[model samples]
Target: MSHKPRGLRPDERELWQRVAEQSVPLHPERAHPVKQVIERLNKAPAKHRVQHFTMGQTARKIAPQHNLAPHITDHLMNNHVQMDRKAFGKLKRGKLGPEGKIDLHGMTLAQAHPRLLGFIQSAHGQGKRLVLVVTGKGKAGTGTGPIPERRGVLRHQVPHWLLSPPLGTIVMQVTPAHLKHGGDGAYYVYLRRRK
Candidate 1:
């Protein structure tokens, strides 16, 4: 990734307290941070397990039923998502464990971005609403740190990534998860089907 890794900003340093304590790499065997998971996935030359959903079918099938107020989509499309602790939850192991769960534990930002879009497309197509993405809060904080804070990376950057480029047009809104589902660490990503 070309993004510069600088020291964490004051705000990020604060965020580090919450994030660093929670996140863990998805693959224990790999021994790397979760943010690097995506890059490794791209280079592994083994398998692409993350499911992909198409844009067209999702637009035609899912968008019509979300009951999204006409203007809400537009507003979300053009606005910045203001994250608040009021909207997040920790995932219950029963509800979010395995089967249909998408494990983002070790995925890199680049790998996670496309897969997240496809996931939204697929879920939207299947007439599903209110999908959950489990982005860890982060594992490194201020003290005893080898990597500088900015490498704290995905902890704060994922939100911007969601609002940029190809994914941005497909998504209408994104908010921090509710308290029952890994709040602040996860996101409630709302997708918009094309008109």
Candidate 2:
């Protein structure tokens, strides 16, 4: 059975009126623009015409999508060269060999930070110039959230750590390692000369 349309109850109408009076339009300009546009269209001649198109016609191109943030490697490369030009070139080309190396795989943030700090400090203290830091490319995230989550927490955080605080004073430059030395998953940390 179909129900008949009925007017709002007296109490319901009073409540609606009170709500309407207190509510504010989010966009006051937009509220009546549609009505104005409709009134103008009714007063004007229907001169506008739709373009003709066949079913197989090619569609117009859409604007290109906004790009994701620059890659981790890009961020590392963009940093100002803090070491000698010749040495930096060799370092990038994988010509410069690390005097020491540290692997930070399978460790929590708490365990990794201190270990990294100690290793860098020790290397600097021993007058080491170039060292390799291995922070394996992080595992892929499992979440399906709207905001994209980056994989490899250590890969991202290690650079910032090397560039800040007690380590920053001793560290000179940080660059991605070559394939033979675990490319993309490791960093070549150039340290300052021990004073």
What are the models' TM-scores? 0.42, 0.65
Deviation in Å, model 2, residue 142 alpha carbon = 2.3
1-195 in candidate 1: lDDT tens per residue? 597778889998989978977987677676557758878878888765977876675554532232233332233335554333232222222233211234476778888777777776677676553567777776754544443344234545666766787666665566655567766566666556445
Query: What is the C-alpha local distance difference test score of each model?
Result: 0.58, 0.91
Top model by TM-score, which number?
Answer: 2
Worst 10 residues of 2 by lDDT: 59-68
lDDT at residue 51 of model 2 (Cα atoms): 98
Candidate 2, superposed: residue stretches over 4 Å from native: 1-68
Which lDDT tens digits does candidate 2 get at residues 1-195?
A: 998989899999999999999999998867497799989989998797889988857977664433378878899999999999999999999999999999999888999999999999998989999999999998977646656777788998999999999899999999999999999999999999987
Show where candidate 1 strays beyond 4 Å.
Answer: 1-101, 141-148, 193-195
